[model samples]
Target: MSINVFLFSKSFAQQHTFEVKNGSFVYDGKPIQIHSGEMHYSRVPHEYWRQRLKMIKAMGMNTVTTYVFWNFQETAPGVWNFSGDRDIAKFIKTAQDVGLFVILRPGPYVCAEWEFGGYPWWLQKVPGMHVRTLNQPFLDSCKTYIQHLAAQIKNLQITHGGPIIMVQAENEFGSYVAQRKDIPLEQHKKYALAIKNELVHNGFDVPFFTADATYLFKGGSVEGALPCGNGEDNVDTLKKRVNEFHNGEGPYMVSEFYPGWLDHWGEKFVKVGAKGVVNQTEKYLKNGVSFSYYMIFGGTNFGFTSGANDGDSPIQPDLTSYDYDAPISEAGWATPKFDSLRSLMKKYVTYQIPDVPDAVLVIAINEIKLNKTVDLFNGIVKNIQPVVSDTPKTFEDLNQGFGYVLYRKKFDNAINGTLDLKGLRDYALVYVNGKKVGELNRQVKKFTINIDIPANATLDILVENMGRINYGPNIEKNLKGIISPVMINGKIITGNWNMYKLPFDQVPDLSKQKSSYVAGNPVIYQGAFKLKKVGDTFLDMSNWGKGIVFINGHNLGRYWKVGPQQTLYLPGCWLKKGKNTIQIFEQQNDVKNETISSVTKPVLDKLNLPKE
Candidate 1:
């Protein structure tokens, strides 16, 4: 790094004021240009934050923007966490130490493709709770949360001699819901205004901003804060929208300039090529537009927290790897895009950008073998005390946020016809009398299947909460299990039932099972391998089916045979120098032998998009 960058530091005592004036941000009475990158604090490991921040600086990015995930912070209502990877305060300080300014988006609803749009799962339980709206119950809760969250980093603002210069209201309010005659879009503008007021009233005194796509600025931006656009290619068009929305007090910027798009499970991963992205960056730079790359370094989803996309299209569940085919890979390795863009940035940036750091090393190891198995049929020992109900309850109704829930019932009479799960939250497997009959998935709109109910046969529907919609309407209405009672032959059955919640919070005890298992039943594969040295690796998922993997008890996230994302990133921080345990729970599998191996690279660019 250049000595000039540090010359401005060494002093956090004297506070300075920052303002948005005449199409630009001015600091200390001088026009300060911001070339920022979006990096989520919750997504990356706390230990590697400095490395990623340093990389952002090396890429010639002058600022770093991040969203504070309400869901991640308040895991349950009123219960809070800000330590370790959830520490946004520490993330900001690290950015300042690395000479990068900060733009904080503390969204009560951040549509970052995060689960429930960053809302806590408990919100679904609130009666008459309408999220991202004007409902008093929701807003009152948001207000309290705002006050609490602001108290943590209010002093980090530029006025307090810290790097934070901007904060955002509810994200992308304009494109949040498609226009409907039944529901007015003006309601969103009102909601945006409410969000701005909430931030200001709760001590977020920094300049607040709202971001959306180019044409949606009017509905997204409130009168008090600056309005920013998302896409590239048309600066003049965006400037016009800002002029029309913010009373010509233009401090034009692109808050979410998408260098790459997010990926959903089963679909081919998306990647914006190096040559074009560099060109696009140059266009914005030449026009003197301040912008932040939407996802500069996309990481992992970690647990069963990957959100879904639901609206016009069929449901799209996000894959475990949050590696959005960005400049930095999921494993923190700089890609060709990083190199090319850094080279182009050198020609425009006034400050000396540091040289690109060496790519993080990845160590691949041989396949580890497992001889013992635990089937899910017997894994029922870990399930919660079964709830009996005439009507099946949702995951939230059962006081659960994630994982699978099973509904079992037996019919008194034999029937052969279509079995309808009026509202299946996501994926489910149908079983009758200990035999797999069929399957249904919300992703494909498959909710009914032809089946036979032998006399008094027990019917079981094991449903997985794929993930809640994080970017659109109907977010609150996505109940995990069956929303209503099973309908056979157009009649709702009122019968005795068992509802078992499988949170997968703890691994099921495998030693007590004394019965034989079905060939395609859920298999818990356990293996152990000695590690000579700890480093990063991508566990090959080609040999396995859909399910989650845990190394040393750390949930690495989900994986499927679906192309584009072929490996699960295994961070070395979770590894040890000696014997390490590998545990995997396959939902349904054919692999007789349980084995695993690691690779040095990620499968980010493969296009396996299905044909229409």
Candidate 2:
């Protein structure tokens, strides 16, 4: 059958009448009920998207909702990528294929525990920019993104053949506006209205909605729209909130019913039990309310996509693993929550829910040992590079992300009092002659330290890009790398910085030299292993420092001295049976060069290394 016909047939088969009455949702022109679950395409791999969809369907859910992240699509402004896991078109199509309706939340601002709340970093660079306001540049960009997204899925609408029945505007605008305390209410409402009109003009034909806290919706300031409350766990409270604002007959949906919690660096992993979810779901369903679990399948925040939250204390950016302890695990495995929710759902729906898909096999490979060691710095100084100026530079000027940057300056005078960093925004590791000395961190704000600089000795100061400040009021001015001037004693040292951008993508050329000497910023450490018979094996990187590992030139993510993630899962597809080349770029020069072995278990140990 043709794609359109197939989509039409599938959508028609799962079609159920839904309407708004007096303000409540009506089914077949009558007040009908809903039970939904949430998931994101960017989190789940394309190959496993279908499996997760089936699992959600089995959980007795009639609808599946997802947030269409703008930054994920427009990785860089104007450039769009919709294939693979990012294919929202295919994701919606697959939802229809598996007998589930979809609700698309195309947020130019999706604060879904995502990096920058799904707003692209490029947007921050706009001149005279004030995000989420009536700023012309910001609004214009939002309009373009909405229009581009609409063009991709407009034809596939439920009114056409797709399962996307509703589209949400800005998420929790009232909370941010009110929380900003400094900003006036009138200014906040003006920004909200501008976003609503932008959506309308961008060909968003479906019903428009906004999710807010219970108290915010009751204020009666928002224009004509459907009201939905987030985090309303109590059935009575949710029903009361709906009745108060949405009228007695409106479709009451829990837009963001929190199913699982998130985690940050240096914290214990958080998890919620299956019983609690089932009980809450049952309560909501029995009370005649429709709900959507915020994240039924919380996927990985791969790369630098993780964001942060602000509450009582100041928290930095989020960890890479978004494993929200939801119904579906980050690796796409079905959990006890899935089974409990599924059993409860079967009691309410009449569809034939299929069995859960098989889980991916994660086997532990054997551990190997490193029998060789190499000294990184064993050369005398010759032809010393001169310093140009004594001015300090921020990370923006250097164009670097996470990791470390070194600042070196040569001086003829010997100073021993105290080395002062004019503006040390974050963390720094002090090293003399490639030897460990001491460290300074921003948490304590100690940027000055006493250091003895030997005469004719080249001074080296290494600074680590701990992490970007992801959320809250202080995020606007977050600049990573070395954010300022370097000084020795009380005098400013002038010279070339020889700035190094320690991004993981930088692969060094290891073919130029013998076992003699290599002087460069990113020194490539290479070792060859002759696999007797390689089928599939995990490379144990516990012996080495934090850095990306490449086997035959295949990127394994960033491995640090942090706990829970020491060994990277190397697929058998990337490994060959014989002689394999392994390369590692250590961000810190202090890392001991050790041989890596194959491990059958995941390494989860904390090391006494400097935190980045």
Candidate 3:
């Protein structure tokens, strides 16, 4: 019996061994090429996690890549959640169950176009905090996070018979350093090394790597870690770039090979054709290179978690749908691209790939009438108490992260002129005496508007925190709402102002609220429909103006009439078989019909691109 136990232990110890050696990835003493696809467990419904993994594996991918979002895990300082959708270990184990390896990218700074680049919003509130830096405060917070995260995933490493063979240290840090001229390169390198060290200290025993573009290697690459490239299409350039930095070594890999592009509000939808993607992927496979599709199955951003980008523009917030036009649709259905890629992968893979999972059930519900309507000021605003402040406070100042903030002030005297919202972060709706007169959008660089006021008129400005900038130097100061005071006719409109905190963390109860819809004012429209059956469906919002949709208390995400994205992808897992309730917060009350319909397919490319 003792001899048998010794043999079993030896076999287990020799089961898995993955390492980067001699310019190639050596797995179990043999060279192997890794075909991986990126998918974030946070973006997809937890109920559909297994299905997504199965679909990716069916696409002939032997490995699955995912980013561990710090902000999603640690909601507040010293507070962490690792259950349900935030469960990284379960996600890894599920990948193993589907016969795929795991490559973990646990970014204290994962700029997957995620909110605040996945840094907890409260991180900005930390005293003397300089994010992505070796600043003690930020590093201390990072250490605590790594410690807690290790407790959840440390034992799941490949060294311990887990599927996680490779772990990423910091995500695309060089790109950030290159954009920020204020910080020194050496300092950034030290900061990157510090994070990698913290991961090592916390029991991450797998091979570590740093990913960046070719030019960013100087700033992003750390000693004792392999340097990989991102977005480099040409296999030659990819190999040359890695060899240049790695003492002429050859196990070249592209950590983020984009199959499709990201979408932002007010812009046309970004699409990548199957021919080009197939061509590039063929080159990678033929050349015996390792690569991972940035998103093989792009999922939904769901709720206020969508982020924005500021690439020499004011601010372009990402849409609710992170579909990325990938091979897999947002509703977990396989697309034509998936078939083409799977066919291409079959030629290279030795083992037989499993057939794609059967498509989930999809049902279309006809228009459901909105039976209840309540104005923003008359009803919804009254639900929360306002913070009395002599000066205007930004969202961060009030300790609020996401959603809207209502700024109110009463004037005893009459006034009329151009009102400028100094420091309007993203978007705002201006109202005079419960009437929405005009709006201010940060995306188009519109911050001032002409307004007429009457004596004793109460003014309210509803500012929506569209999203925090996910990339570049601008990420540091992404303070939403009005950061400064209001100005009318070049004069400061100052006094005791009331700032209402509407984080919308919890959906408000409108069951008892009476209907009071005022045209042109933000209204909460509620309705219920009997659903004897429920499945994946899309809520059509093309006829409605900009606002958010909440179904059965789940915040589906924001919608706008601007264009590109007109429907919110509602997962079937969130719906019930009986009655389902949907509440919409329409900003301009521009709905041609006060009702919505659920369709079988998503309407992502319907473009009403804003006329600047």
Which candidate ranks first by lDDT, i.e. highest?
3
Candidate 1 vs candidate 3: the TM-score winner is 3
Whichever of 2 and 3 has more lDDT, that candidate is: 3
Tens-place lDDT per residue, model 1, 1-612, is 111244226564556777887666887777766788898988877888988888888888988899889888887778888888888888888988888888999888887878888888888788888887778889888987888788888888887778898999888877764532245767766777888898888777878888888687756667787888888468888778888888775677888877788988767677688888888888888877788987888888888778888855557888788878788777777888888989888888778888766655679988788766776666543445789988898898899998888888888889889899868888888888867788787887778999899998888888888888887666756677888777887888776888888887665555665433566766677778998898889888876767888788788887776556778888888899999988787775756655788988776544454365
Tell me each candidate's TM-score: 0.94, 0.82, 0.96
Lowest summed lDDT across 10 adjacent residues in model 1 is found at: 1-10
Candidate 3 weakest lDDT stretch, 10 residues: 1-10
**CA lDDT of each candidate?**
0.79, 0.64, 0.86
What is the TM-score of candidate 3? Answer: 0.96
Q: Report clashes for each candidate as comma-separated counts.
A: 1, 25, 2
Please give the ranking of all candidate structures by lDDT, highest first, separated by commas: 3, 1, 2
Candidate 2 vs candidate 3: the TM-score winner is 3
